[model samples]
Target: MDCEEARFGLYALLDDELEVSKNLEILSHLEGCPTCHRELELDMRVKSLVQAQLAAPAPSPELWNRIVRRIDQEAEVARRPSGGVAKWWPTAAALRMVWGAPAIVLVLSFSLWILHAGQVPSPFVEELVQEHRGSVTRKRGPVDLPATDPAEIVRHFRAEVPPSSPVPLLAQEGARLVGGSLCHVGEAKGLRFTYEVGLGRIVSLFQMPRPTRALPFWPRLGPRYIAQSQGPGVLVWGDARFLYGLVGELPQEDLQRLASRMKGI
Candidate 1:
């Protein structure tokens, strides 16, 4: 299979929706192509992350009945005799009838199920977790632009990341500044800073502009919000200017201590 075909079948392969023969073909292609393999790996990780975080509730019998009734009504409309504008009514009006209420209810039900599961991790936290894992596991070091001085690193980011969010020099005792990198936290441009504490433990600090709307679901940590149990650990906070997130494998208390230090910076 070519790259395009492999990519097209990737989701089906991950979800086990493909036939045995098709799955084998894609798998073979992925094994031989490093780029396709990485893409598949990233897709699987994202799906796992989303499924782990979001809860899917079983659709109620009444909801199913309602959807069936809506479909039946549309079918009846389609079978009706055509006259004047009524000729176009079956094609256009039936579609609106089928999709309007039933589609909305299905979407709403799914949304409620996700919301009911637990606190939803923000996109920023998701990106931080992925970056943290990548940094720790990769054979090479993490930083793209290396520097000891936080100011110099911030300067580099300002020139690189658009809209220029401030990269705070986190004041945590024993935490040595490693360097920084330009990255994306969700759709917004941001900067990531790596720090080392005792025993060569790594902590990542991510900063981006505050999103237009605040997320109401995330758990609060003092003034900041936290997305825990998603991966490693992440603490998020922000003000009028920028949103800041700290991620690491450190204990919750330890991460909180690090976040608290940043509050004064």
Candidate 2:
């Protein structure tokens, strides 16, 4: 299967709803395509998160009592004969409305939660991670621009890529630049800087325009900075003009250190 075909059936494949033959084809495609594989992984993570949230703890006894009382009232109404209506069975419409309202409310609440979740750092971090994974797996030729000098990369981006902030050049020990490229996540257009840390490990940092409102999360390392793991090691922080997300597979401690040293733009 090609990328488009594989993506089309990704959800079905994840939920094991696809036929065996089609599933096998998509699996084969994912095994060879890092980009598609990353997308599948991301969908799986999101599905699992939603499931966990929906599988909320049992309601309190008082809450259960309230629900049972409501159900009992519905049952009584269903049993009572009204006008020409028989009591043998309730009308499908009434049954659905009475029984489905709670579930409908629950689903709506979950949807709103997902919407808010997509608003800031978590979803944004996932977007950066996908971009980083793409960069890691993309083929590179010898003719590509050199990336050893962080300053040169910064200058290049500033001069050539309009409407971008100065990408931070890590001054930490044993860190080296591994080139950069113009990239976008949703409506935010920016630059992606790849780097090689100890033992050839790769990390990528994405810089984009600062969001109008900041909704930060933990482990709150600073007043304006917050970091969290989402399928990879992700550290998100922002300045007055731009937001940055550093993504990699390095230990969170190591990632935090690298992020902390990201000063002086």
Candidate 3:
């Protein structure tokens, strides 16, 4: 096997999940390959340390009896016939875990990748698109409250960008931060920071490097503009010559008000 494939397999081998034949094949490869031999040695040392630490745990005899009983009970359940159907009913705790929303979401996120499996972008294109989505927490998901006062909002946002980066200074007079996310913009990652102002409306913030925007960028389309979705307004502008698209629910007058607040034009 190739070194890269073998390196990935080494962890599974250490875990003893691969077949004996596959392990022998990997060992043969590792024998001839000095690089792989080094990797295997490292993995062996780490595994031995972990196993030694794990082996230190000693269960009490009473707890061991309970574990044995539980295992036997599970085995009996597996053997029993449930109304002539194959036996496999979950215990009560398992049912609760199965129905939990967070668990459902975790499973769905993994499945969602398969559902959206499309043409994988080339490395060049992959390098261009930005991933701006942030982690979703259990309680509030990803959105966060925006600072109402312009000075505080400026202080907050400035901290996000690096000192050497070309992000514009804060000029959002009346807008409040609603929530924000990082999103992909063509080939580059952009920050999708959203703001809400008067009348329960939203103004989105898009931040991206100006040059790497999609195929049809500036001069042909626009330097900066606003778009709407589901009644919410989005303001797209460029900073340090980068593109930023702000999207949220709101009116036209307020939306432009949100847009013009930045000096980037």
* lDDT of every model, 2 decimals: 0.72, 0.71, 0.57
Which candidate, 1 or 2, has the higher TM-score? 1
Cα shift from native, residue 116, model 1 (Å)? 44
Q: Per-prediction TM-score, please?
A: 0.47, 0.44, 0.35
> Per-residue CA lDDT of candidate 3, range 1-265, in tens?
8898888888888789899998998888889899989988898998888878653546654576556657877876776776654444665435554666586697789878754552342343212112212322223333333334545544554555554545443257655554454445444544555454433334456676667545354566645555555434566665445666555554666657666776655
Ranking of all predicted structures according to lDDT, beginning with the best and ending with the worst: 1, 2, 3
The candidate scoring highest on TM-score is 1
Error of model 3, residue 5, in angstroms? 34
lDDT digits (tens) for residues 1-265 of candidate 2: 6899999999999999999999999999999999999999999999999988663556555576567667877987777667564655665556756987898799889989876764443434435434554653354311233465777777767764453456677767877675676665665666677776754456877777776775555435543454665445887777777778888878778888888788763
Of the two candidates 1 and 3, the one with more favorable lDDT, higher being better, is: 1
Runs in model 2 lying further than 4 Å from the true structure: 1-133, 136-146, 160-164, 216-223
Which is the leading candidate under lDDT? 1
Tens-digit lDDT track of model 1 for 1-265: 7999999999999999999999999999999999999998999999999989685657665687667767877886677765666655455445666777787798899988876653443345435434654553244423467576887887766676563445577689978786677665445766788776544456888877777776556435444666686545788777776778888778888888999888454
Clashing pairs in 1: none
Q: Which prediction has more favorable lDDT, 2 or 3?
A: 2
* Candidate 3 TM-score, true structure as reference: 0.35
Query: Where is model 3 more than 4 Å wrong at Cα?
Result: 1-162, 168-172, 178-187, 211-222, 228-231
